[model samples]
Target chain A: MTKSLKTVQLSHGGGGKEMDQLIKSVFFEAFNNPILCSEEDAAKLHLSGPVAFTTDSFTVAPLFFAGGNIGKLAIAGTVNDLAMMAAQPEYLSCSFIIEEGFAIDDLVTIVNSMAAELHQSGARIVCGDTKVVPKGCADGLFINTTGIGRIIYPDVSANNIVAGDAIIVSRDIGRHGATILMAREGLALESELTSDCATLWPIVEQLIAANIPIHAMRDATRGGLSAVLNEWAKASNIGIDVNESAIPVADEVKGLCELFGFEPFDLANEGTFIIALPQAIAQGAIEVMQRYGHCQQAAIIGHATSAHSGKVVLTTPWGSHRYLDLPQGELLPRIC
Target chain B: MTKSLKTVQLSHGGGGKEMDQLIKSVFFEAFNNPILCSEEDAAKLHLSGPVAFTTDSFTVAPLFFAGGNIGKLAIAGTVNDLAMMAAQPEYLSCSFIIEEGFAIDDLVTIVNSMAAELHQSGARIVCGDTKVVPKGCADGLFINTTGIGRIIYPDVSANNIVAGDAIIVSRDIGRHGATILMAREGLALESELTSDCATLWPIVEQLIAANIPIHAMRDATRGGLSAVLNEWAKASNIGIDVNESAIPVADEVKGLCELFGFEPFDLANEGTFIIALPQAIAQGAIEVMQRYGHCQQAAIIGHATSAHSGKVVLTTPWGSHRYLDLPQGELLPRIC
Candidate 1:
């Protein structure tokens, strides 16, 4: 069926027979499930207990990028949000806004990527909406994913961090932002910096199963580590002090940041996350992350402090400390 | 704070300080709620029992139409999908993709419109995402809303339409499609036509409260009445026979359809809905709709039959019958 179409036509989103065929052949075929195939206005689910709901709209430029595409980001972004809240990712609703004349092949690749990403988190795209606008009305495509899941280990929040909590980062930072920057600059083939775009549920699940006394957890997405740490400081009314040299940054990412005059700590990491926990359990958490979560670079890089509340301070390698403020102005637009 | 900005810039979506300010000053100011203001990665919801989940992406051209804007349509559309499933609209997650340089005032207006429409169903915007693309990457703005609610009256489905069930329409159809067409064609003010863009949860809640014994319920949205009837027939494996003259069509909508060489049944309706129920209580259902649902033109227009299964036959005033097929091609794009 996909072979019959070269590019998407406006009629494919006209809510007509053409639209039905397009949906059945492309979308339904990729994200097929019993609940989705029920042909109902909405998917019916038997849910009980406290649930976590999050949504994200992916408008990453270039559509295709190193290591992952917009479709993978859409699924993993929403799933990670739920996982950060100690939620077991379950159901997701996807919506696509496509431009007329988008290539059917590219769309197939994107949808297939989304289906594969969902498998990583054991989540299902139970319902979806599609809209195709005329040429120039939109870029190639924008995907919005909203997810709901049961809160397995509740009380994980940005405001839960205590003054004595240690902050641990999963893996390296800035790969996602550097990869996108490289792609946008047409330097992708010259570098090995691929996006850390992945589903974080397995890591989160392991952390929960290990009974690490987590106070707060967050993915360093937009505004990167600086944004998340600053938000945590303000939300929890505590100061966060970090050792600059202790944080992990890939060499390629650091080189890219140097070339662009950007800070690796201020760039996004799609698959990386930060956890705040008691200092006593921080090493145990890191061990679990490395041994079972597949996060070999996981390390404790900071700690919450009562002094200088509502601030994030970073101590440089030379012992000079300065505030790590929330990123200001535009670093990158449509990076994810 | 909104007065400080004339237009949205790429920085507003950079996942930085500017984006945070924009979100708090605009989105949070309008859709303020405890859950949304919690500042967590995901909104926590305590949901139980059978739940209905649906999603819709609104890329309606012109952004603002005769009766409502894209924001209102986004809210109403997802709510209607849940309502069609006999769900009590409870929570919604909204994600927006905005074009750079879009007017801040327009964004405020759209956000406020969404907040206002959400009041109709007592649903809360619990979580949301915002992305801004570079200029020309998208039109003014596009919104995707995903909703979840507990199904109050279960067993209502298209496949539940048994033979001899009465079919009823809530009110006149095609106003939404005609209004958008007029707006897009620059003929909006030439006539008094307006889109029937409204939230239908109140009407649906009333029907459920009245114990309508609804077998099937659907909003005649994109693809309109013709699509809904045909889909119901096919899903239920029953035949649907409709009286063409009995289906209400406002004079303005009819005139516009005539001018455009389109069929009223094929045009869209945002607020309008069709229902299938026991023939014995058809009049009672109409009375409930007219008196309490504010559907003054509510009337019985058809019934399900054992013959001609999987087909929708429309009886003309001339005593001729023709199959009412699902709309075949583009009638109007971005009709919402």
Candidate 2:
């Protein structure tokens, strides 16, 4: 093969002449198919009735980093989205944004990582796209993911969320964000921290096995407790009141945030969640979360309310109370 | 407030400090959820049976392409995915990867387009995420999408594909790809080429209304017709032989491909399909497709076989036989 031009260029990502050339030279020849040839905007089929869909993007820097890579993030992000709906994710597709001169090895690492994660999630990588930009236009790698999960639950909806619901969180908050920050920032901390990047379907199975009625559930991510609560409040047209001290946070997280001027509540957290259920069933939900070694710190941090409207308030240890607000900005980008 | 950074950086994309800064500064503040907090590889939920799933990604370069933009692509891709599966796409989540210094107008345009598309598709943007990257290390924009659709077909699977099945196409091949190629390549031509980007759920509804015994179906995408056939071959474990003369390709596409060194059989198509039906229902199927407007060029190019053993072969204009292969690599990468 001729080394036409060793470096990636904006055209590669432009979907123009250069992009056509790269794809024809590499991908089309390798993956040739008639359906792929027409290159329409969306695939059409004769499939009918009830479908699940999802999307995600990986902005992981360095492309290849510790624990996992961009490709892995691509798969995990979308698969997790589907799982959040209590659906079994089945299909996945992705788009890639690569800066010029991005290492092909790094791309491969990302792809393989995605493959591994997809396999673990029980999903198939059915469709995808890739683009390359100018060298000075982008970081080495970025990936966007979309996934579809089979609709196993027909009755579950935000409308089903009700008041007097119990709140249950799985695991500690901010592990993934804190760990990544510590690792990248080279925080000389003797305390070991790792990204809480595990999958949660197994834990979900445990909860479902309890045969309990859970009103609503959400993953506590970028906005941490405040964001999740606010969303639930707006969706269910109710307020959520919480005992701040009841929530779980690690000593390491407290130390790191206070030192870095980060707020534990506003800062991002990984592998955490908030579940709304009847106050009576709150204990059962927590018991299910505890079965998973990951949820050892599960707690009932709040209850849904109808009075305060779309706001979440927390009763802090201090004499005064604090109203937790939705994270004001990007607290953490691609923690998942 | 502090001019921390306007453009995205590798650290921001990473699951670390910079990533934290980006999210804290932007997305987290806008939308927060407990599931999102889980920073785990996945957020799982327990569901009440048969489900539907779909996923899509967007990589329309220039961040503000002519026809639409990344945002529209993101939404349309997932919506269409659900539609093809015969599911009513209900909820959606969007993920974005943006480069630094991108024109805010372009972002707004993309978002507006997405909002419009979502409306047209009858889907709600229930959840989403955004990530920013360093200017030099990222593109102007990219998006990933996932959606939820309710499954309506009690009996829909590849298992029904069989020897007597007839393959019906929804429309002419090459419109979407040719138009994209022409537009992206700046190919000045007598024929104005534009993408055949349209929703097919309505047309699909018409097909189902016909009440024919439709067995297997697939959307022609990355690999085009050959890829779909290959998938059908293995999926249903049956062979299919196509008659090239019977397959339809627009004259514009033919002329454009020859001029650009492209192959109509090896391009990316988003809005084409290969549907399998019992031989008895083949003509009726085509008639139904033609009535749908989108299926005007619909043709019965092939039939399922048992003897050939999961292989797809094409009988050419020259009366010679050739095997259709899967695209080995990306074709017109990032076209979506």
Candidate 3:
């Protein structure tokens, strides 16, 4: 039997003993289920009406990073995107571009992380493919995942959001970005931050179960909160006025941002989220999100408006408001 | 406006002028669809019924070459995989990993090529992402695409293949492989044999429309026809007898294989396919395939048998037979 924890080689792509060993040791162990165990090139399944489809690719540098690895990021990224659309993530396909000579132990660790994350989030990886490149041709690993889900709710999209809708954030901002920066900079802080990389499906499911009319939902990702808010404003053809005091920022994150001369709002986030709910139910939504997030900081940070269409204005603590645009360019590289 | 034929730089990932230019010059033009034109982070759509999902990563070395680039191959590769499963190619997600300092023009060319290919195949690239790695961490470019298509048929699986089925090869074997070899080795043939990297969805759609019950199907990719056939035989616990004379091979590929002491059967094929059907419907299926291939060279190269179980035996013209097995390893690295 091939040893399980050695560095991986091109032999793994040969579809022979080494390949089998790798699958059994890593992917199969992490992603195994009745459907995945079949190991077909495509997955076949029975389904009901109104399906939702979403796909994402994860290319986090160092593969194994400070707070989370590429595997968790891959699963969480797609599942969160689906949740934002009010779709229950059902099946997923994982494709890997593995740099030859990557350590098997690292691959196994990453795969195991993915399995744990999937199990926790109630998502399954149903089909997958793996490819290897010459040692110097790629980083240790890059993963791309595609997901399919059933849209229990027929009405879901940014188009559904109305001008009077109220915007609610699930929790504090900038933890994911802060953790990544700290990891990269090797900076020590009074309060070490962990990524808010938890799955939002449960929270989304809860909201749907309560029968709330959601106009729009999005997880603050590459562009951060400001980017997603600006995109929502633009996409919905409405204006949003957010109070900086109401936007939840961890005190430590605020301190770190000030020191680093970065705006926490524009930083990358993996765990934070934003939701647009009917104005009348905004407070109730915040209450529920606080119960789930266990963060007292959940707040009604902004309100959607009819005037000054497609722009987001942030009201500063000094009473002056400034237009908050989507991330203009690269703030941090490889945050995902 | 970004010029169409300019070099792509790392700044394309920055969501600035380069990024807008990249999307406008290539994706907007080739696809020419409503969804792709929006150029949003996600593509919203309507859907119904069961769906088939598949993902593939393309890390072919020498990213740019004579026949196709990584982008086109990336789209065509996933679309073809979906078609092989008898699914209507609907949506695709493209993710890129760029080695820093790679050419921006090459990236644009690749994206345009992919757009043209996807448009031709009747598939749309709705969602995509980009990432960059420091130089030496990757080859110039690597692309991973994941696709979701509706399953138009009720049943499709390699397990559906029975003990006695006819196997067909759409056309000449190893053109894709030989072309890669010629480019890599600089071995000139009598005529240029560019890789046949076209999408097979049209031909597949025609086959499905013919209402033939295909027991099994597969693209003879990395490990080649021999590898796929062996996998089917093992999965179904049956034996296969292939007619060596009936097996189509281009003269250039044959000459190179002989000179390099290689077997055409074991080489990677980017454009060819392998399919299994009941013996009675085999000829009809072949007719259906040829009608769309525009290359009327579909041939019955083999039959599934109960004897010599779990093996692929090739019958030579001289009445001699040779046992063919799955390819042991890569004949060429990153040949798509």
Best by lDDT: 1
Where's the lowest-lDDT run of ten residues in candidate 3 chain B?
B1-10
Clashes of each: 0, 107, 8
Report the C-alpha displacement of residue A320, candidate 2, in angstroms: 4.7
DockQ of 2: 0.14
Off by over 4 Å in 1: A292-294, B292-294
Question: After best superposition, candidate 2 residue A110: deviation in angstroms?
Answer: 6.7
Query: Model 1, residue B55: displacement in angstroms?
Result: 0.5
lDDT of 3 at A60: 67
Error of 1 at B133 (Å): 0.5
The lDDT-based order of candidates, best leading, equals: 1, 3, 2
Shift in Å, residue A321, candidate 2: 4.6
The value of fnat for model 1 is 0.90
- Which lDDT tens digits does candidate 1 get at residues A1-336? 544989998888888899889889998999999999888999999999999999999999889999999999999999999999999999999988889999999999999999999999999999998888999989899999999999999879899999999999999899999999999899999887789999999988988888888899999999999999999999999999999999999899988899999999899889999999999999999988997443899989999999999999999999999999999888989999
Note the residue pairs that clash in candidate 3. Answer: A137-B138, A196-A271, B6-B105, B7-B104, B7-B105, B8-B104, B8-B105, B9-B104
The best-first sequence of candidates by DockQ reads: 1, 3, 2
> TM-score-based ranking, best first?
1, 3, 2
Query: Model 1's lDDT to the true fold?
Result: 0.92
* TM-score per model (chain B): 0.98, 0.81, 0.91
